[model samples]
Target: MDLIRRLFTAALVAGVLSGTAASVVQQATTVPLILEAEKYEVVTPPPATAAPTTTAPAASHAEGHQHGPVREVGEGVPVTLDEAMQRIGLTIAANLIAGVAYALLLAAAILLAGRPVDARRGLVWGMGGFVAVSLAPSFGLAPELPGMAGAELELRQLWWLSAAAGAGVGIAALAFARNRLVIAVAILAAALPHLIGAPHPESAEGAVPAELAARFVTASLGSAALFWAILGSVCGWLMSGVVEPAESRPALRVQPGAR
Candidate 1:
């Protein structure tokens, strides 16, 4: 019971701190690249019409600002400082929640393993999370910028989930399962997702420039990596501090009263 309480406490603390760190890293790296990608989306030329004009369509000032809403905000978002602040706050909150969720998963896994949890092992688990969630799915989907056209949302989501599940299960089996046959099954489970292939659009549309898209993908992946690292390290450190000593302490024996 004491261990469980400490586990929860550690997870909460780790989640909040790691999530804040992720947000800061995102703001510094990913956010700038996304903003740049948006610029390209704004500038993309409209597809040619079947009506077939001998001359190019006249570009207007409005064309330069393609978003149909406030120039300072996303389409349909109001241009208000308060709204912006609210959005920022919400994003940070979401990040914190995600951090907590991952931390909980890591904590549970460690407990199940019945092994000593420390910063190093926690970090390994964090890398597993990254591989399962980010790296695996990316092989198929890569990353996309706003306004980029791609596969149907449902199909893409399904594929991404499959990939994550496969990789995660495979990694777990490989690490934990003692039987060779079980490990082989795990390997197959992991490979199956990639073999099925990622869903693709009927046609690739490049609304954002290729270079910008590439940069954004790299930055996004980097941010995720950093987030996982911090979360794993913090949780591991805290959990170890609480659990290890308690586990190793010798049991106390009471002697007969000598009143």
Candidate 2:
């Protein structure tokens, strides 16, 4: 029970810090690109017969913007300071939640592996996470901008999970396995998801420019890398007793009292 409590405490702290950092990175990079992409998002118009008045189209367009791509602010409308702050707050909150979840998982893995974790080793573990979760799946499905075409959300999600899991297993095997056959199997496991391929939209066309999309993908991956790095290092440091030297101290010995 004590170990569990300590583990959770470490995870929570690491997660909050990692999430905060990730939110900053996203606000600076991905958020702007998403706003730009929203400008080019394609919205289907209401049929002419449904419109009783000329103003209907305008109303319909506004409604479309509200429903599309999770963008709360209206199109062509300047975002107020309050709205911008609200958006940032929401982003940070969401990132924090995600960070906590990730930290918990990473911590569990470390415990299960039964390896000594330190800040330096944690960095390597974090990079391994980046490779498993980001780099591997990305080869099949690069991160998409708001306006970009994509496969059905469910399908994409399914593939992403499969790829991440496969890559994780493969990474663990490579790190721990000494047998030649086991290493070969690990490589195959990592490759299997990509070989099956990711689902894609029938048409590749999208309103957002390819250059913008490329930038968004790069920024997303970079930010993910940053998040994992912080999470791993902080979790390791905390769990390794470096952050709580008193708690980690050995019990003091009582010497025989001199009369």
Candidate 3:
């Protein structure tokens, strides 16, 4: 119970800090690009050749738009305060939740390894996570804007999970296994996904400007980097504080002739 409580407490603090930082940076960088892309989401449906009784709205999904749950807000008109608040609030909430989850996972892994959790080690874990979860996957997927078409969700999800798992294993080998043969295998393991290539739709098209898309991609990566770094640092520091440091333990002071 005490362990659980401490872990939760640490997670709460780490999550709040990491999530807020990621959200703010994302807002500053990626949010605007998403808004800009949404302006193009008002697609007119293909002419109804089938029936005159068609009750479908005059506007339907754009040809290039991939169906998904990502919210599209940028219309021609200015955004209302309420709408802005809602979006911002939702973003904040998402960040907080994600941050907490990542922190909890990191803390558990650290404790499991019987290693000291400190800011430096946390930073490494966090960065490794970013590499495994974001950087490697993005090499193929990148970030998509509204109306961007892609391969089926299942395919993407499968590849992503496999890639992450592979990267994790490869990294573990690189970090822990000392043999040259092990390192070679690790390199191959990490490179395998890229070698096979990520699945993509037949067409590569989107309504968003190339420049804006590029910016958003860069910003998203940057924000993720920031999030992981903060999570590691905060979680590490918090956990270290919660547990007594090894060096801080009272050293055995032997008196002369005590033996």
Candidate 4:
């Protein structure tokens, strides 16, 4: 129970701080881009031969306008206080939750590695995480903005999970393994997802400008890297005090053979 408490405490602190940072960064970088893209999300007219009763086209247009759960607000309309607050609240909450989950996972890895923890080491691990989770998968699927085209959600999600997992496993093996065969396998694992290829939309048409989408992807990656770095460094700093290594323990002193 004590061990668990300490772990959770470290994770909670790291998560909150990192998550707060992520929220602020997102607000500054990604939020405005998303809003601008949403304004361009007006439904494109269907082909003349397309059936009017068919809803697939309309559904696709509607889904394309959303980056996530947030509803669309119209252009030139004033954003109400409540609505703005809700968006902010949701953003913060989501970031916090993600941070906490990531922190816990990092903590577990650190424990398993049984290495003395410090900010520098933590930062390295965190960067590794960003590469595996964000950078690697992103090669295939860059961050999507509102009014952007993408493959089906389910297919994308599966590929993302596989890519992240493979990259993480491959990285870990490459770092620790000594055997040549194992190293070769690690390289293969990392490359397998890209080899399989990510699903893509039939057409790459999108209402959002190419420049905006590129910016969104870059901002998202930068934000993720920042968040992970913070979470890792903080977690390591906190955990350093939680689990005392044998070498770090103080030596008992004898007072001139007074025993």
Name the candidate that leads on lDDT: 2
Runs in model 4 lying further than 4 Å from the true structure: 44-78, 241-259
> To one decimal, what is the Cα RMSD in angstroms of model 3 from the true structure?
6.4
Off by over 4 Å in 3: 50-78, 179-184, 241-259
Residues forming the 10-long window of minimal summed lDDT in candidate 4: 68-77
Is 1 or 4 the stronger prediction by TM-score?
4
| 1 against 3, candidate with superior TM-score | 3
lDDT of 3 at 45: 45
246 in model 3: Cα distance from truth in Å?
8.4
Tens-digit lDDT string for candidate 3 (208-237): 678888888898999999999998888888
Give the whole-model CA lDDT for all candidates, comma-separated.
0.79, 0.87, 0.81, 0.86
Q: Write the per-residue lDDT of candidate 4 for residues 93-167, one digit (tens) a residue.
A: 999999999999989888877777888888888888899999999999999987788899999999999899999
TM per model? Answer: 0.78, 0.82, 0.79, 0.82
Candidate number that wins on lDDT, 1 or 2: 2
Considering lDDT, where higher is better, how would the candidates rank from best to worst? 2, 4, 3, 1
TM-score of 3: 0.79
Error of 3 at 15 (Å): 1.1
Residue 256 error for model 4, in Å? 28
Provide C-alpha RMSD values for all models, in order: 7.0, 7.3, 6.4, 7.5
Per-residue lDDT tens digits for candidate 2, residues 1-259, read 8889988998999999999999999999999998788787655744446546555888978976866644232353357999999999999999999989989999898888777788998888888998999999999999998778898999999999999999998999999888989889888988898999999999999878999999999999999999999999998988784233454558877789944
Off by over 4 Å in 2: 50-78, 241-259
The true-versus-predicted C-alpha distance at residue 110 of model 1, in Å, is 0.9
